[model samples]
Target: MPVAAFAVVAGVIGAGPVIAAVQGDPALPERTAGQLLADAAQASRSGLKPMSGTVMQTASFGLPGLPEVQGGMGGASPTALLVGSHELKVWYGGESKLRLALPGRMSETDLIVNGDQVWLWESEANKATRVKVDAGAHEKAGGHPKPEEALPTAVTPQQLAQQVLQAAEADTVVSVTNTERVADRAAYQLVLAPKDASSLVKEVKLALDGETFVPLRIQVYAKSSAEPAFEVGFTSVTFSPPAAENFTFTPPAGAKVEEKSLGTLVGEHGADRGEGADPTHGRFEDGELKGKIRTVGDGWTTVAVLPVSERDLRTPDTGGQRGQDAGAIADTILKSAKPISGAWGSGKVIQTKLVSALLTDDGRLLVGAVTPEKLAEAAGRK
Candidate 1:
């Protein structure tokens, strides 16, 4: 997990139009802060009923000095939010079926999950990858896996809200503020702020549907900032269950297809299934990571040390000698990184407004929201 993700994530619209207004509605019982927390926690643990709707996500990372990063997706460059107000059509049929669509300029991409199978289809490329789901996965009784676990796409509020519930209670200030309208539905605002002053996060707020108690919107802010740097929420929604046919999919003819088992899709049988429950420290489950991930600090400014792997970074054609080229890829990334030295030793440092990273002489990637000095200190720690 990215350090800020230890805070929150999302997408959005033109900043000017989202000042949510609360219209007169039924008198829903006012919930205390404790009750609200309990309710969110319950929602996280319970099974979601069938529902379908459109969710619009928008993000703006307030990276200072990088004028190239200003434009959200759809623009030429990249922003912290990943892309512009990404609209997704979402569907859920209890626990047995699920589907989502991401509309694009030329073609829409989709994913469908039914029974013990999941399929990801890219219409533009006319390709699909199908994988069998684990029979034991459903029995675990937990919130759905992260979006990356579901598919290589955006995660729904139903899934992300559960993550907040589990992580917030331990180090955050939970409270209830005023109500707002989300997707035209009345909503109760639940705000969570990190108690640690060293945290770059200002706060995270979730908008719970007044009627169903489901989260409709989530926003993340940086410390001392007025606008949300990242946000995702429903622009419109309906609680009605979707038609059964909506959860099914048949790849278009001529499309390429690949099959994989659940373990291959999720790395249950990967190179190293280390003994830890923390997702943030994991780098090589799918094999893109060729390193040992270990945290160098605790709490807000935790620095992560990832040992670089020459094999993972090399091109497929590079073959055998790639292992000997250890820092080759790290060096490529260090082109923009500046040289720096500390008591720990000399290395390269990359600093953005929100994220700071250090590449040590020994091929270790130390990164965190803290400054380079902090990362250097962490790299030197005994």
Candidate 2:
């Protein structure tokens, strides 16, 4: 997980946007915080009816002095979300199998819930577990179980209104800007700022549909920061009932069963699937190979090749130790291995197991290797 975090950081830093679109007028008129919140809450409740649609989710992390890190895990490559009473479903590929929150536990693996019982399946672990949920358990897990931790962060139209109203009650002003188009529907822009600076959320902005009152966009800003730390934009949505099987869960035959907390599973899986830093670039020199490199996984070494405009990195003839002299091939491999920053410290270091040079689909040269401690550091009982 730590290695993945580092790689994500590198990716985010490498990608940055210079311009941002203005959705609502900042000088829009103000309304009583209560009225705005009430309207928002009402809209949320009414829109909660059985519905199904696609939803896309992405998470980005930013730190001081470093570039931002962004990653997305969703069933819809770019979008997926479903709404319904009998069955609700959402999927984010590569991030998690499926998620279900029942009373007292949250499962990010595959899950199926029927009235009083919930079934969970973990394909990677080849295990299926069942649990009975009651009213008490629901309350303990926060009224209702959600698939992912990010779900709670999303505010429905009604929830947005209620939150705006609550902020108003606290003497915070709620301002509703002019209606604007989002996903082809007119939406009311609402902004709420706290009267005190010590509040958990400094400010929240929401875009609610004019007719359905569904939330189209949400932005959250930190107390002392000017930029939004988190943002969710709905590209598409629907209000149709989901399929009956959407909520059904059945374990495959011969699967193992066990009792465990959701937190335990998340911690365990996160470490196992975590990524590492980006590889450094280098080349062969003299009888040795030298270049920038980073350690990943357990005993895995990764080398990044600098983009060369004149050279094609993907030719098969470029690889294979058989063609090159032993000394030249060894030197080429060693020369390409350079130290990577922030991948190691006094207590941790990356080790290489094997090295393979290949070309990416886009014709870029890539070297894949294993790190020794990478897996050990990321895998353990939560």
lDDT of each: 0.58, 0.38
Q: Which one is best on lDDT?
A: 1
Candidate 1 colliding pairs: 1-280, 11-57, 11-58, 11-231, 12-57, 12-58
Per-model TM against the reference: 0.64, 0.39
Which residue runs does candidate 2 get wrong by more than 4 Å? 1-35, 44-47, 54-61, 64-108, 134-174, 181-185, 193-203, 222-227, 258-382
User: Lowest lDDT 10-mer window, candidate 1?
Assistant: 10-19
lDDT, model 2, position 190:
57
Q: Which candidate is the best by TM-score?
A: 1
**Clash statistics: count for each candidate:** 6, 41
Angstrom error of the Cα, residue 111, model 2: value is 3.1
Give candidate 1 misplaced runs (Cα > 4 Å).
1-28, 62-83, 114-120, 127-172, 195-197, 250-292, 309-333
Q: What digit string (tens of lDDT, one per residue) describes model 1 on residues 91-129? A: 988777889887767777777888867887777668787
lDDT of 2 at 93: 20
Q: What TM-score, to 2 decimals, does candidate 1 have?
A: 0.64
